[model samples]
Target: MSEPKRKNRENRQHGDRAAALNLFPLPPETEARLVIYADLLHKWQKTINLVAASTLPQLWTRHFADSLQVQAAMPAARIWADLGAGAGFPGLVTAIRLADVPGVEVHLIESDQRKCAFLREVSRETLAPAIVHQGRIEDILPELAAPIEAVSARALAPVPILLGYAENLLDKGAVGLFLKGEHLADELTDSAALGTFARYEFSSIPSVTSVSARLLVVKARAG
Candidate 1:
């Protein structure tokens, strides 16, 4: 990298880190861990497609804060399953945030081996309470016996598809907390019209960081 470009990237990262701290305001230890996480992400991102290149400049608000808000929505959930845990949005972030708490476990389910490696590296370095599951979501969900209290995903799939992926856990009484975009209302309506999500009750809360985003909460209706 040229001198000017290298300096510019360093400056951008410093600014991004500052913004992350300002938005979240976590405990000192948690803040340190997230800093490390962000550093590793930036390093790995050079070779691996961990995040969108466009969003790289705003890693703090766009990715970290977005994931942190999901954690904020369900603070009491001790055991979590993050499906399609691409780049470990809410999953690894949840684990890091809850690492100090007792009995907190975040299951990160991803099919891609490379992403799993990345998740593992972050977990090991940050000592985050995450279990990286490197296999198909369908294949791994059945084997988990952690009594997960909640299941989460971000930019993974549509409502019905997510519910389908989480059906096993939902049937076992785990709540689903999915991060979604502005079109969530239409997605719900379309899924309802198709009766694809009849078994689950859906509700949404606005995202604290992004006006165009929402946190979709799902639970199975009683028989």
Candidate 2:
């Protein structure tokens, strides 16, 4: 294809994606919170790399909206648990967006103390009403005070480890909402070796310009 044609085609594809996706329109408060989140991340990143420095420009599409997609998926009715909730992507965003939904709660789980501190501050600054856990999946899942309605992860770990770590919560009726990139098919094949599940749905993240932005939702049926 000619260069101009290719450029136009790319622009059209981007436009289509923007239209088909329910991307979050920036609310004044949400926008402010995102600014705060960015500031904190930059300050911390001087010592600890939270997200790839190259990804800063795409932060809104790749991080916030990507995670925020979860809120719209469920109609703001379910309890959510975000595993390896590093830098608080969907978990913090979900908490912020789902704030007014009665009985909605989001749990942000992380093992690193520094990241835990970040998550807590995110909740504080965003008034996200999210619970931050500073421990491993094994350390906290079994002791959860109540069953969770939803569980999710993003760039957390491979599907196999995610499935293993979240097994307990999954057994307690939690549904999975995980974000995966281009290699999703390969990861799913690897995870299938573990066992069987009741349902699995894969949807591309329309809000992301990043190629292969897909979210996987899995349900673990009671055995």
- Relative to the unseen true structure, what is the C-alpha lDDT of residue 138 in candidate 2, on a scale of 0 to 100? 76
Q: Write the per-residue lDDT of candidate 2 for residues 130-157, one digit (tens) a residue.
A: 9999999778877778568888888888
Candidate 1, residue 215: the lDDT equals 96
State the lDDT at 134 in candidate 1.
87
Q: What tens digits encode model 1's per-residue C-alpha lDDT throughout 1-223?
A: 9999999988997888788778778999998898888889989999999999999888888888889988888889999999999898989999999999999999999998988999999999999999999898989999998998999999998887887789889989999999999889888888354665777888889887788999999998899
Distance from true position, residue 206, model 1, in Å?
Answer: 1.0
Residue 137 of candidate 1: its Cα lDDT? Answer: 90
In Å, residue 2's CA in model 1 sits off its true spot by 6.3
lDDT of 2 at 40: 77
Best by lDDT: 1
Checking candidate 2 for backbone clashes, the offending pairs are none
The C-alpha stretches of model 1 lying farther than 4 A from their native spots are 1-11, 191-194
TM-score for each predicted model, relative to the true structure: 0.92, 0.79
